[model samples]
Target: MIPFFRKIRQKLLSRNKVTRYLVYALGEILLVVIGILIALQVNNWNEGRKQEKISDQTLQSLEEEINEARSNLEKIISFNERILELSNRFLAGELTKDSLENDPTQIFYLTTYAFTTLNFAITEQELSTERTILGRQSLNAKLRISLQDYLSMGDLEELLGNFWNNEVLPYFIEKKMMVVYNRFLKQESINKEDIQQIVNEEKFVNLVATTNSMNYQFLNLLKQLDKDLEEALVLIKEEEHD
Candidate 1:
């Protein structure tokens, strides 16, 4: 192809067809420029396909993580709900000290605490970087909001832990109520007076009330997280089709 064009140019030059030769030279330059542009376009297209494939794989991994997080969240929510229900009953006098004394295991339930430990694929910083990579506005927004909600639960969990360590545990120790917990562990019968003391103590009741309130807040956040995860999954499914 090069030799053929060279021969044509040589013929035009030999004939001193200067004007036609200039036109032919310009045409060759135009063809070369067009070819370069076409090659760049093809390269760009291939690169785009590679990036899209990577984004799809990332989304799938995120979906799996979200489902696993949801499963864990469901179990935590159920456990805490039981604690809330039991605490409410005890506070309202629906659960008598006699009932608790019969089943020391019930004391274990009252003393138990719930803390948020849900995990997710998107971090605060990663969300922004992922937005640029994934190029899905709705999915990105959902992820950002969901992660914020999820991270905020950490504060509530920390508060609950501090309350248990500082207030509730101290009260138990000061009142010598640790004996009740020890009896629970040994599966031994609890002393009636100790049971009555725990059930009737004003400070203990207040502690249970405070924990119940925190549990309600934690449960609400978990429920919102569940909803956001569901929405995120839906968005991922849609993108898969696209």
Candidate 2:
């Protein structure tokens, strides 16, 4: 193709067809420019496709993570509700010290009440890739932007960590809840009056309140995350089919 164009130019120059030569030269330049533009467009299209594929994969991974988050949130909510029940019962004298003394349900909630953070490890490297994908999504529909907001919040995980580290575990230590817990664990005979006295204390009540609050917070985030996951899955499914 190059040689053919060169031969044509040579012919025009030899004939002193200056106007024709200039026109041909201009036409050649225009063709070259058009070719370059076309190549750039193709390259851009390819890059976008690559990023979209990465984003799709990331969304799928997020769905899995969201499922885990939802599961954790559900467990937390149930446990918190149980604690709330226990608290209410103790205060109302419905759950006597005798009942509290033998309550495995209450013991489990207190012992394993730490935050279980969701693993976003899949997105560690894919966030930059997802920004474009997220930006292009519908925010109102809990699409990409909503997912972005959910991811950015990280509140559920942080809430659990804060309570466990700053309040939950510390309260147990500072308020001697742990001592009561240890006594329970040691299979020692707990005086029914002492158990009643312990549950009715200000510290134990406060812990119950905090636990309920923490669980509620976790549930709220998880609900949103669950919605976001459904929205994301719909978007991804449509994209995949398209």
Candidate 3:
């Protein structure tokens, strides 16, 4: 193509029709400019398609992450409910202190602690990654907002971790230690009345209060997480439709 244009220019220049030659040269230059513009436009269109594909893939990944988060939240919620039920049983004297100390109920609370710890660790990493991806300013605006809200729910979950460690664990540990000490120190001839009185003391009452507060906080957090998860599912469905 370059050789063809060169030959045409040479023939035109060799002719004495300078005005016609100049007009032809201008026309050739215009054609070249138009061709370059068309090529650029095509390249831009291809790049746009690639970007959209990337955005779609990112949204899909977010959907999977949100689903995983929902599952984790549900498990946590179930665990919290069990904890509350156990607390109720203890408070109502449905399960004697001796029974609580010797039976699997104590093990249940310990297992809950372990699970909560593990879940918090794993969720923190997932939440951090979600935040990083959401922070990417190059992402689509709707996706960014949806991810931000999802991450906010994660932040709420992280807040619950503090309640677990500081408030909940201390309360359970004190109760467990009292039961263990009483059982071991006064074996066979356990003073049930005296033990109940001790557990009903003002300090113990405060500890129970703290435990209840923590449970309430956890319940509230779970509700918020459920709402966010539902919203995220809706967002994913809309994206799929789009």
Best by lDDT: 1
Model 1 clashing residue pairs (backbone): none
Clashing pairs in 2: none
Q: lDDT of all predictions, in order shown?
A: 0.80, 0.62, 0.58
Model 2 alpha-carbon miss at residue 18, Å: 0.9
> lDDT tens digits, residues 44-102, model 2?
99999998887677666755765676577567556555655655565466765457655
lDDT of 1: 0.80
Instruction: Evaluate model 3: give its TM-score.
Output: 0.63
Question: Which 10-residue span in candidate 3 carries the lowest summed lDDT?
Answer: 110-119
TM-score of 2: 0.67
User: Per-residue alpha-carbon lDDT of model 3 for 1-242, expressed as tens digits?
Assistant: 88988888888788877887889889999999999999999999998788667666766766676677667767877877777676666556675556644443242242132123212332344345654334443333444454555455456556546755675457557665546444544443344443454454556545544555556565665657566556756765776576
Ranking by lDDT: 1, 2, 3
Q: What are the models' TM-scores?
A: 0.89, 0.67, 0.63
Pick out the ten consecutive residues of candidate 2 with the lowest summed lDDT.
107-116
The CA-based lDDT of model 2 is what? 0.62
Candidate 1 regions off by >4 Å? 122-126, 131-133, 179-194
Candidate 1: residue 11 Cα off by (Å): 2.9
lDDT of 1 by residue, 1-242 (tens): 99999999999999999999999999999999999999999999999988888787787778888889889988988988898889888878987876776664665566556676766645344585764345688988898889888788888888888988899889878878787778777878766566666677777778878887888888898889889989989998999898
Query: Judged by lDDT relative to the true structure, which candidate is superior, 2 or 3?
Result: 2
